[model samples]
Structure formats: C-alpha cells, structure tokens
Target: MKTLWIKLLLWGYAVFSMAPLLVMLLSSFRPTADIFDDPLGLPTGPDLGNYAKAWTEASFSTYVVNSLIVVVSAVLLGAAVSLLAAYPLGRRRFAGRGLFAAYFISGMTLPAHLGVLPLFYLLESLGLIDSLLGLILVYAAGSIPFNVFVLTAFFRQLPYELDEAASLDGAGPLATFWHVMLPLVRPAIATVIVFQFVPLWNDFFYPLVLMRDESKLTLPVGLTHFFGEFQNDWGTLFAGLVMTTIPLVVLFVLATRQIVAGLTAGMNR
Candidate 1:
C-alpha cells in the first residue's frame, strides 16, 4: 500500500510538472481563435500550418544554426582548454599550485554582473561585439573555471601509480595524458559536455548583449520577437516555444542514462 501510494504521488507530480509543456504542445496545434476561445480545451483538430509559419516567419532555422555554432565552438574549445589546465593542476606539485587552483576556483563564486561593465568595454575595444565569435568566447571563458575544477577533481582521484608506470615505460607527460588519463575520464568528459552544452545552447544573455541583428539571434532571443506590446500572437508564439523546447527534450532523452551514470561514477570515485 505504501509503495502504491508513492507511485501514485510520483505520477501526480509528473502530471503537474508536465502540465505547462502539454498546454504549450496542444496550443501549437490550435488556431489563434480557438486558443483564445478555449485555452485549456483539447484541440478539436490538429493544425500543422502553425509550425510551418513559425519556422519560416520567425527565421527559426537561422536561429538554430547560430545557436549550434556558438554552443559547439564554445564547448569543444572550453573542454580542450580545461583538460589541459586541469591535468597540470591535478597531477603536478609545483610551487604555488594550490594558489593557482584557488585562483581558478575563485572565479566560480564571482558574479558575471560585476564584470559585465569591463567585459563589454573589452569586447568593444577588441572589435568582438555583435559577433557570434564574441559570444562563443564569452561562453567558453565562463565555463572554463568550473570545467577545470571538475576535471581536476576527477583527475586527482585517479591512481598515481598508473601515471608512474607509464613514466617508467618511457611515456612523457603528453603521452601519458593522451593514452592513460583521458581514456579513463571519458565518462566525466561526457558529463561535462552535457552539463556545458545545454546551457551554452540555451543561453540568452550573452547573445542578447552581443548579437544585434535579427539574423544572428539564438532560439531564446528569437522567441522573444513573437511578442508585441500591442498584441500577442499566443498561438504562433506558443508554437515557436514548442519548437525551442524540442531539441533540449531530445538531448535529455538521449543522454539521461549517460548523465546519471557519469554523475554516480564521479561520486563513487
């Protein structure tokens, strides 16, 4: 009876959590008049035209490409840079290594708003403002400190004997890392990729600050264009919103098991 009640509660919670998303999905198939007439009613008939109009009219295709480019570039470069920085911090015992590690970790606690003024000026001076490259750089830099911390923690837990044995076998630092440590850390890397990529893909603030043109807007920013002060096209707006949500939903579905396993793998270590 207790187990049945728990399952019932879980089902109820799932329904409550999914209510908004279900509404949005249903609204996408509704005509504007039907949406206003019956906000919560099941769609009497399905309409695919709203999605087509939302895609073409709102330039969502462009937004998707822009988002993909920014996210992929940032995650790839950020992960690579972090691996390089983390390995040394985790494995080496140099003078001031603790200080350096603290310095990097300190960035995690610092607020982005505090640095926004200087960052804007710096980007403007470097001619990076209003460019996708600028957004990518900002995302990559923001993610680096945390990624380094995570990767470094994972690396430190690794057996030193493995590295020492490799050294005995005439392996240099680079060779040891590429051959020994990296392969062992694949799950952590997957975890980091999932962790970093989702936010980068969904980020609205950096792109809003740096991208001025409509063509360059990412999905989150692009979705905003559907709202007008005078009137809101709730149907099309909700349709576009549904479109924005699909990619994230798909990614989570595909990576849910990996994310869980990776998280526990790190914890177990």
Candidate 2:
C-alpha cells in the first residue's frame, strides 16, 4: 500500500508539471479568441496560421538566426576557455593555484546585473555595443566561471594514469589534453553546453540593452513584439513560445544521458 501510494504521488506530480506544457502546446494551435474562451480546453482544429504569422510577420526567422549565432558561439568559446583554465588548476600544482581557482569561482557569487554599468561602458569603449559579437562576448564571459567550476571538478576526478599514459606515448601537454583528457570529459562538456545554451537563448535583458537593430535582436527579446499598448496577440505569442521551447526540449532529450553522467561523475570517486 505504501509503494502504491508513493507511485500515485509521483504520477500526480508528473501530471502537474506537464499540465502547463500541454496547455501551451494546445494553445499554439488555437486562435486568441478561442484561448480566451477556454484556456484549458483542447483546440477544435490545428490552425497552422499562427506559426505562419509568427514566422513571417513577426520576423522570428531573423531572431532565431541571431540567437543561434550568439548562443552557439558563446557556448563553444566559453567551454573551450573553461577547459583550458580548469586543466592546470585541477591537475597541476602551481603557485597561486588555489587563489586562481578561488578567483574564477568567486564570479558565481556576484550577479551579472550588478556590473551592468561598468560592462556597458567597457563594451561601448570597445565599439562593440549593439553588435552580435558583443553579445557573444558577454555571454561567453558570464558563463566561464560556472563552466570552470564544473569542469575543474570533472578534471580533478579523472585518473592521473591517463596523463601518464599520454606522456609515455610521446604526447605533449596540449596533445594529451586535446586527444585523451578531452575525450574522457565529453559528458561534462555536453552538460556545460546544454546548461549554457538554455540561459543564453532565453536571456532578454542583455540583448534588450545592447542591441539597437531589430534584425539583430534575439528570440527572447523579439518575442515582445507580439505585445501592443492596448492589446496582445496571445495565439501568435504562444506559437512563438512553442517555437522557442522546442529546441530546448530536443536538446535536453538528446543530452539527458550525458548530463546525468556528468552530474554523477564525482559522486562515485
């Protein structure tokens, strides 16, 4: 009876969690009037027009392109840099190593918003304001501390024998990291990529502040175009949301195993 009750509770929680996503998916096929009339009800028929309007009229195509460029570049760049920074801190004993690791990890305690004014001035001075490159740089820099913290842990957990073996095989430091150590940490890298991708894709504040051109705006900021002073287009907005959400879902599904492995890696060690 206790097992059955626990199963029932788990199933209930799952349903509760999925309800909002189901509503969003169903509403994406509906008109705004129908959504207002029955917010929880099923769509009478799939309207397909909402997606068409959102894609063509709302310029989601452009937003998606910009988001892809910025987020992907930021994730890759941040992960590479974090890996480099983490390796020595994790594997090598050097002067000020602990202090350096603490310095990188310290960034996690400070919120990015607190430094906005200084960051804005710095970017402006570099003439990078309102550019995709500027946003990419910001995202990459912001993600580094967290990525370094995680990757450092993963690197530390790796067996030192692998490094010795690589060295025995006539590999240099760079070659050993790239060829051997890097491959072993693929799961951690995937975890970092997925974690960074979601936030960078959904971030609104930075893009709104930094980007001046409509064409350069990311999906999260551009989605606000669906709102009007007097009214809002709920259907198209939900459609846009569905489009925005799908990539995240697909990515999570694909990387779920890697994420699990990465998170559990140090536990057994």
Candidate 3:
C-alpha cells in the first residue's frame, strides 16, 4: 500500500510538471480554431507548419546565433577568470588574503541592480552599449563571483601534496596548475560551464536594455517582437518558446552525467 501511494504520488507529480509542455506541443500542431474549441486534445495530425513559420518568419535563426555568441563567450571567459582568481585564494597564504577573497565574494551578495546605472554609464563611455561584446562582458562579470567561490572551495578540498610534489619536481606554479590540477577538476569545470552557460543563454533583461538593432537581438528579446501592441500571436509565440528550450534541453541531456557526478562527488567525499 505504501509503494502504491508512492508510485501514485510520483505519477501525479510527473503529470503536473509535463502537462503544460504536452499542451503547448499539442497546441502548436492544432489549427488555432481547434485550440479555441478543444485545447486538451491531440493535434488532428502534425501541422509542422508552425515550426517552419516560427523558424523563418520570426527571424529566429539570427537570434539563435546572437544568443550562442553571448552564452559561449560569457561562459568561457567567466570560467577561466574565476578558476585563475580562485586558485591563489584557495591555495596560498599571504597578506590581505582575507580582504582579497572578500572582495571577490562580496560581488555574490550585492544586488546587481545597484551596479546597473553605473555600468550603463561606463559602457556608454566605452562605446560598448549596443554590442554583443558588451553583453558578454556583463554576463561574465556577473557570473564570476559564484564561480570563484565554488572553485575556491573545490580547490581547497584538493590534496596540497600534489602541489608540493609538483614544486619539488621543479614545476612552476603555472606549470603545476596546468599539468597537475586542472585535469583533475574537469567535473567541477563542467558543472560551472553548465550552470553559467544556461543562464547566459536564457537571459532577457540585458538584451532588452542593450540590444537596439533587431538583427542583433537574442532569442528571448527576439521572441518579444512576435507579440505586437494590439494582438498576441499565441501559436508562433509558443513555437519560439519551444525553439528556445531545445538547445538548453539538449545541453542538459548531454551533460547530465557530468553534472550529476560532480555534484555527487561533494557528497561522497
């Protein structure tokens, strides 16, 4: 009886979570009229036309390219900078070490909005305001704090014997990090990549504020253009949403094992 209730609960939760996606998928196929008539029913047959229209008519291809640029650049830069910065903080003892760590860690606690106005001015002076590079820089900076914190903890947990052994072998600090440490932290690196990249890909606010050219708009910002002042095109809007989720879903599926292993390593250790 307990097992039966547990299964029932699991099934119920699954349905609750998936029901909306199922409805959206089905709705994408049905004639808009059919949607008004019976939203819950499966498509009479696959319309597939909605996807093509959403892909071409909505200019999603360009949006996809822009989003990829922002996400990939941000994640790569964020991970590299955080890893380098965290290493010294985690491994070395030095004067003002606490203050330096606090400076980096403080960014995690402060609300981003507080910096937005100043950032806007700074970017404007640098003439970076409408550029993809500007967005990449902002995204990378915003993600650095938490990534640094995570990497710092992970680095601290690593055996210092490795560093000492490498030093005795006449390896420089850079050589030790490159040859000895980084290879072992691939799992943590994968975790940071997924965590940072997903948000950077999905972000809408920065693009809404920074991207002025429609051609330069990322997926989330471009999707908004599909909705006009007087009318809402539910079919295409949902199709755009579906398109946005595909890349993220694919990324999650491919990296699920790596992400799970890294997270679980913390528990098992």
Best by the TM-score measure: 2
TM-score of each: 0.89, 0.93, 0.90
RMSD of 1: 2.3
**Candidates' lDDT values, in order?**
0.85, 0.91, 0.84
Over 4 Å off, model 1: 1-4, 44-46, 168-170, 229-231, 266-269
> Which pairs, if any, clash in model 2?
none
**Model 3 CA lDDT for position 16:** 99
Mind giving the per-residue lDDT tens digits that candidate 2 earns over 7-37? 9999999999988988889988999898888
**Candidate 1 pairs with clashing backbones:** none
lDDT of 1 by residue, 88-117 (tens): 999988999999899999989998768877
CA displacement after TM-score superposition, residue 160 of candidate 3 (Å): 1.1
Please give, for residues 1-269, the per-residue lDDT of candidate 3 as tens digits. Answer: 99999999999999999888878876777666666677687787867777787788778788989998889889999999999998898888899989988998999899986788899999999999999999999999999998988888878878899999999999999998899888877778888999988877878888988879899998877767766521355566666667788888898898898888778766766
Error of 3 at 155 (Å): 0.6
